[model samples]
Target: MGLRVSKGQSIAVRAFLSVLCLGVACFGAGCDGNDQSSEYIPENGAKIGASVADVMKDWLEDPDVPAAQRAVLERVAATGDMESLDYEQSWAQYRQCMTDLGYREIKLQKYPSGLYIEALHLAGTARQESKYEEDRAQCTAEHVEYVQAAYAMLAGNPNLYEDADEAVVDCLHRENLVAADYTASSFAEESARGEEDDYSFDIRDMKARSCLASNGHLTAFIGDDVEERLW
Candidate 1:
């Protein structure tokens, strides 16, 4: 899960609550007993999507990937599910780490992507705040960052799209939320106007909202079908 620190509310959480989101969660999950040393490689095939095996194959060769991340990848490969990455557990670890650091009332919000920071109450002198930043960085890095990325690889845009906008546009079209004559070009134009004036499709429209939420956009204007957790 990714998090943003804020005093009043979280931008990501607010955006998430505004749209109806949809997701499929697999019930069964497990990982193969793969030797996770320098000799490790992803022999397990893709369980979630066709591309996951390929992604795991590439990441195995990248030296920057930490053992924790690689282990999560192996689990994802074995189970064909993002939950195998165990990001929620890691987020809990992160939350506990922050709480132990003296941060009180660390509110969290749930999103289709995962847990997000709804609010954080940070108070101290400038020097202490600076030290807090350093600690937050350390805690987040050790607990959430890479595991969250691995989970996102599956949870975000089931199509594994490189462009979030394009994925959302395609999803809108696939769900028949837009007119048959609507083109990506038209959507692009609307997006420009939408940003400048917030003139996008009415977020209150249920189909449109769900399409936007699932395809990875348009979850910032309405509220339904979500969970808010205080962490």
Candidate 2:
């Protein structure tokens, strides 16, 4: 999955994350208190009760979806922007693409926190950190990770072979590797802190493995889950 960078906004990651947060909230609140028969309506506080796994499972079972769309969705599930599409024309184009692919009614929940996270990321990336060296360095490092991971996954797929820039490919590979190391270390630290249970530990490890397999490393841009934790 190539990350198309421009002067405007990036929506894929933000939208996916919004869905994840919404799904998590729904699952957490509804699992015990409410019945599954209770449809998750957007209003009346039902949408806020869906779980992350529930939403993810729905995406996995969607019949009309193709592998390419799923892969892209999965890649950005942690950070897809679902806020107002007013930044650029591409936001509309991407939304249209997803609708055409039949994911219009993908999630019946609304997670406002996802928008907050996206806004934070956009703000951080948008600002020139001339006064704060540490923040600037961290931001640069994070961007490198995101770009690298996307390219690494893209490179591993033969169907997405597009010849263009040698330098970009090399940079992506290098950053991907670095990201992997950092992710593994971070997981270990979190485990030590008892911040992860068996399921979460396994999920984190799987993410590390997935990134490693796709990019041969985990670049600084370690995807949405890890980034959310940072926030």
Candidate 3:
């Protein structure tokens, strides 16, 4: 996950909260409307819609496609709303692709929001988790690219502290809190550990918060007191 420092909130506090939320897997709880599909399609909607059409054209042309599904695709294309395409179909294809590639115990589940692939069984080993992430990335490459492009565009905005990210990294390095090239992957591993351990804040978290605060990246507050000051 990306670090989320607010305008006035210290980066240290934000890092603390980020770790806390990751530990509990509650970071996305309020993300009901934050679907990748709703991101602003920079450059008039046609480009992205066309990209989706190109990727799915072959699947749509298959004789096995249901008439109703075909109608939905046609409607989505006509309206340039690529998010309306059948995600269930794409998910099935992804699962099949992973299985064909020798992944076992791959399961998909539907929540109220959307489908999610569960590969925890595949995460038993570092190599297994790496392979699972790689294959899963391959399966969702097209969609991932589109969403990443949208986020990249958003990050390009000058108003959203685009430069601040680097500054925070620099601060962390100067304090010997993290490596110069510390990445989100580092935090992701920590988050996975937090989840497995039932969300307990640990020494690493304390050090991160302390580093941010000492570097003038955080404010003093405790527990819910910080929540009241949120932007």
TM-score of each: 0.54, 0.19, 0.32
Task: Give candidate 1's error at residue 201 in angstroms.
Answer: 3.0
Tens digit per residue, CA lDDT, model 3, 61-178: 5564445456545554454343424555555665677677786534532222231223123125677656765776675543222222222212222122223333333333333445
Whole-model lDDT values for every prediction: 0.46, 0.27, 0.35
Clashes of each: 2, 30, 0
- Give the alpha carbon lDDT tens digit for every residue of 60-155 in model 2: 455544444454435444543211332222223333443343332111111211111111122223222232234423332223222322333233
Best by TM-score: 1
What is candidate 3's CA lDDT for residue 134? Answer: 74
Off by over 4 Å in 2: 1-62, 66-90, 94-117, 120-173, 176-186, 190-231
- Over 1-231, each residue of candidate 1 has an lDDT whose tens digit, in order, gives 211111111122222322212221111222122111222112221222347655555555656555666677677667657673376677788779877987653555355345343232334677866776677667766675555544544554345444434444455555445544444455557554544234234444444444444433433432233333222
Q: What is the C-alpha RMSD of each candidate to the true structure, in Å?
A: 14.1, 20.1, 16.5
Q: Is candidate 1 or candidate 3 better by TM-score?
A: 1
What's the best-to-worst order under lDDT?
1, 3, 2
